[model samples]
Target: MKEVIRSADPRIAALIARQATQNRDRDQLGLDRISALLEAVGRPQDRLPPIFHVAGTNGKGSTCAFLRAALEAAGKRVHAFTSPHLVRYNERIRIAGKLIEDAQLGELMDRVLDANEELGASLFEVNTAVAFLAFSEAPADACILEVGLGGRLDATNVVEKPLVCGIASLGLDHQAFLGDTLNEVAAEKAGIAKRGVPLVTQIYPSAIAERIGEIAHDVGAIWEPRGLHWEAGVRQGKLRYRDRQGAMDLPLPRLPGKYQAMNAALAVAMLRHQSQIAIPASAYGAAMGWTQWPARLQQLHGGPLFAMLPKGSELWVDGGHNPSAAQLVADYAKRQWTDRLPLVLLFASLQSKDAAGTLRPFKGIATEVLTLPIDGHECRTPRELAHLAESMGLPARPCSSLSSAMTALAKPARVLVFGSLYMAGELLALNGPLPD
Candidate 1:
């Protein structure tokens, strides 16, 4: 994995190598080390612009994308910090609506590493501190921070105040860190809510919603749920949003999948609720047409990988690995394949994931499954995934690599390469750079 990481600066490469080695030896999920690291770095987290912090098992990245688009649409500069860069480490830190430059990123990493030499900070913690340092020095209207793990103890939770906080779709993920149940997961995500801040959320089961509300109340944060404080619906090809402030009609999200509408709406609601930057109605309309999140039902277009397939073939990629995400993918595919086209699945996942549960949703929809391995993660062997697929009554084959699986395609089929972000990263690197 280190060999594949590309940067124009040698210092950036050295910093990444050192952090990767440190992570391999001392990676743990908690805030104690991160807190000390940030303190050593001059407590940059406290100096960020008004922040919009978000957390969830899925859709959090999409939500961040929507927020950036809306802020940029309003002609305001925005700083965004996300996790697990699909192809480049630069993707994790966006300063003023652009990926951080290699020289600047290298310098920031060196400063962070030097300050936290004895703290043994994990890779994610060090990355988070660097982002904060950059954001603190740069000028931006707002900052969007996405939780890298369970929110309560996530490295991004050091912010004491934010303009707004949001929790996108929640489900069972990272069970070892968060709890096993949906309610428990909701509670962990709700940990980002700060005193006097507005926390927006999507509709959820009563139990899950109640738990999140309890956490919000405990932290002195105001809970503004979708169905209660505001609401959004799609009608006649438009998104109808209504809240106490007022009502507005905006274009539907340009992103694929019905779930994205909720994410876009959440961003709209958060912007509308906060008056920090004065987002006009026009910005809301622009966001609907401008936002895009890659690797979430993304269609491959005009690339080496696409040319290898039959004419008019569709190749899609999604990095959804949890059971809840699997169900969403299955539902989306059911609607997409209503014309009854053959669906071929090229999949890989980490070892800790439940392969059976994740693949169960596509049992009837997927015509065949090609199981492969995620190159750098502790993933299930291709043979093990094949056995799981067979038990589920789905035709399965083991492939040594993604290239091998693509070569076995009989015709131009509606192919889906999913199951892990690491696999999606590899595909994007091979196909071409992601669309700007």
Candidate 2:
């Protein structure tokens, strides 16, 4: 999918606009451009602190959040890079423990873009180069990187030797770039495995696990999978985690959804398996409450958008656009709202996503689905989406806007606005508690 970015700072915006015009293909995926770009900028990837590189179809961002939270709780200074900013462009790069200032970000953008005179680098490549440059020049104990797409040729994969590498839950996403089958997608993600580096991963089916183990063996990486190397689960009310080093009873993550516990466990395994960083057992317990990744089943309390709903109504939002992610959201809603309250869905998805697969999980659970169009994106038409939903026996209607849909709700209901992350960003811009 093509990425669209805007900055409030004029200097940054101008550079992004110029770069967008120079490259005709915005979604180019390869390490050649990024490698050359970094070479031109002094090869910052080689000068960074201990790095923790993570890649997967989903939950990678949350894992990064968990890693950051745990490190910060240990009183360590950390740098992180995540993609697809929710509110502002600066959200993608965290310099030590805070977002990069506008002046510094603009300067970095100018430097990276100026170096890309003839490389025809994609926007994401430029973003990666800028992040690496900033991270190399800063002082931090660790740097956590979330892969932008499939791991093998992704720009973030330019880092040769990371302290530890982790793979979150595997799923069939980006089929056009990765592959068609589940094994193919798993191979693409496991490509991050490096020689002698421990490749920590979540549990997968037997066939998929065998495929990943083959790749790990080919690369000479030590495969540390969940079921075999470490185990974690929610037992009685707390999280029970056990590994070779020792066992600890950690607190459950503050983030909603039971799946978050697995993401947190991955972070713990990645941290414990590595020898470069020293993390106390207490840090793992504290990380459960400190971790925060917005737009994944986030609830809105007060804002311009929140006031539009009827009195006593609950507003929830998620940025899940794939079948696997949608299934999680559906399951969570089924468990949380079984008290006879009406469940309404405000949905939108990009043209690249599987709209039918995403909407199929919410068919019997949602009382009604109100379809909307995503601004500045190639999204399915509201009418077409409504027809698709209706065909699946889900009562749906096309609405002009979120305001109109919210206004049409005559009584109190539990409303879930989900699908495209762009739509989630739009809602955050109109609501409170933007991602920081």
- The model with the greatest lDDT is 2
Off by over 4 Å in 2: 24-27
For each candidate, give its TM-score against the true structure. Answer: 0.96, 0.98
lDDT of each: 0.88, 0.91
Off by over 4 Å in 1: 1-10, 21-27
Q: Any idea what lDDT model 1 has?
A: 0.88
Best-fitting candidate, measured by TM-score? 2
Where does candidate 1 clash, by residue pair? none
The TM-score that candidate 1 achieves is 0.96
CA lDDT of 284 in candidate 1? 88
